[model samples]
Target: MIPDHNNRDAAATPPDALRVVPVEPSLHRALLRLRVRPAQRDRVGSMADLLADVTQCPGSEPMAIMRGDAPIGYYRIDASARSVAGRDFAQPARGLRSLFVDADWQGRGLGARAVALLLEDLAVRHPATRLLVLTVDCDNRAATRIYQRAGFVDGGARYHGGRCGPQQLLLRALP
Candidate 1:
């Protein structure tokens, strides 16, 4: 069950007790400082680029992946699935973009937890959202594994022109 909004703690707490909150001006500076490993950049855009996308692109919102009071990572939700995947997903489908966990937080289940929280938040606030879609560099085995474990399945679409080379589309349908 989704936690009750009346209970702020429960509403803020997600899988593994990680707190996922909407990105606020107060957290932007800290979130911009969160970075993945040097090589992971090709797979995930930097927070600054993500912020710009949220601005230039409509129908997207920046989210902060927080651990306690500290901003630990970032993710963006794009209500217009077309923005990311260039396909006609259901009208309410959201593009899960720019998911990045700081290098120090990698391998600690942080990314998965952030995804869980985002899913719950969407279910609560955007009930019409039918699915979540993303594209990961096909060679990012670690991220692919994490998304697979979090219930995303290959959507059978591949792109050859991504900045990071071949990419595989993954989709997770919301219940």
Candidate 2:
């Protein structure tokens, strides 16, 4: 079992065994056990709610970030721009949504690792996708930094459609 720690050290690196994979039946129970901290509830919402959103929305692909056979985080890639950015994208883009690390796994840099892998995975999975779009809440500076580090560029535009408040629409071109 992974040890629980409350301190979040951004510089920490993720384990080498980490892999981002689609959420399948065998991993469903483990993914359901993952949760973000209480303070992050509004930003990412509860796992149950996110799962429900994936189910109700067509073209939404739910993925799990795993270490061996255990899930450490979760996210979704939505083909519909409206479902992710709440607006039409200028080009062929996939929306990255509902990304979050489990509360027990927060400080380990797994989020960044998952993103790097996800981007690589996207190129192969979506050969025609020219861009990847996502909206980060304005107040979520940490998340913004992580995305920025992963090469997501911000255009200084605010998306006011988020449940918490205004969000920055960040974009990155996919290979």
Candidate 3:
């Protein structure tokens, strides 16, 4: 269990054995091969695209979701939601962007597990964060369902800027 950043008395549930690691030179080739399903290629951008954005986008941190020795998933956390989105986006919120599980790892429930672990770690790392946010293309029912089951609430905001157009914004409170 990881200790909460604000309250050391509390601990967030740790991933069974998965760890989210920072990007490293040695992992570049492996990380580059991680991809979502073919149909999802349009809805969800590639890891390469995320890497490009990470370079120009300040306050965005790219991370690799590692299980034992291999990277099973990839995601980014935006610390400056105010600057990326707007002030009304659940204040002091961290935006979860570009979350993707490898095509081979799908249907194993790893995505939700990864999200749970990531949120717990974020709570410890960002004590001031009151909420976590993410945007999903409305048609991506699978992704939406997993997030909702994980406690993300639909914020009723649609974004026209998504790759597939019209994205739904979801928000979750952090302890």
Candidate 4:
């Protein structure tokens, strides 16, 4: 079982036992091809579109989680000068876009770790930013839980016409 860091003492043990590294482009594409549940097949296309857009955008940044030199997962952060979903999104507060790990790498807390890393990198790059926002499927309990663990709170907004049901807005403040 994964140790609960919140309840454990500082010297008790190291919180994360696994290593997560940034994703390389080739490995990122390869890892993305790994199948999730049959119902999630549509995620592949959506993720692909986001990746392409981020790649083409002049200011977007993408990060990957790796076990050593091999990529296991990746996520993207997109900055918009204007509001994205009716919220006043200005400089620094990047939108958390595509985030996915290889099917074989799920359930290892890599998702949370990957997000933590992404937030850390963003904080370093954009010191003035105070918020991170993302949209997940309302029905994706697993993804919601991961985001919550990473300090994201429900923003009470939704986007329609996504494959994974209505998108639920979530946001968190950076340290």
TM-score of each: 0.88, 0.87, 0.85, 0.75
Compared with the true structure, all predictions reach lDDT values of: 0.80, 0.81, 0.78, 0.66
Put down candidate 4 lDDT per residue, 46-106, tens digits, no spaces: 5566567766876666665555445666676667523335466543566776677777788
Report the Cα lDDT for residue 42, model 3.
89
The candidate scoring highest on lDDT is: 2
Rate residue 2 of model 4 by lDDT: 21
In the range 86-123, model 3's lDDT, one tens digit per residue, is 55553578888888889998999999988887887787
After superposition, candidate 1 runs with Cα above 4 Å error: 1-7, 10-16
Model 1 Cα lDDT, one tens digit per residue, 31-114 = 888888989877777778878778887777888777666778888888788877898874568888888888998988788777
Q: Is 2 or 3 the stronger prediction by TM-score? A: 2
RMSD of candidate 1 to the truth, in angstroms, is: 3.6
Q: Report residue 67 deviation for candidate 4 (angstroms).
A: 1.3
Q: In candidate 2, what are the lDDT values of residues 1-175, reduced to their tens digit?
A: 3321211332253554676777776777788899889888989887778788888988999988877658889999999767666677777988999898899988888888888988887877788998888999999998988999999999567888788899998998877
Better of 2 and 4 by TM-score: 2
Q: Could you tell me the lDDT of residue 38 within candidate 2?
A: 88
Residue pairs in clash, model 3: none
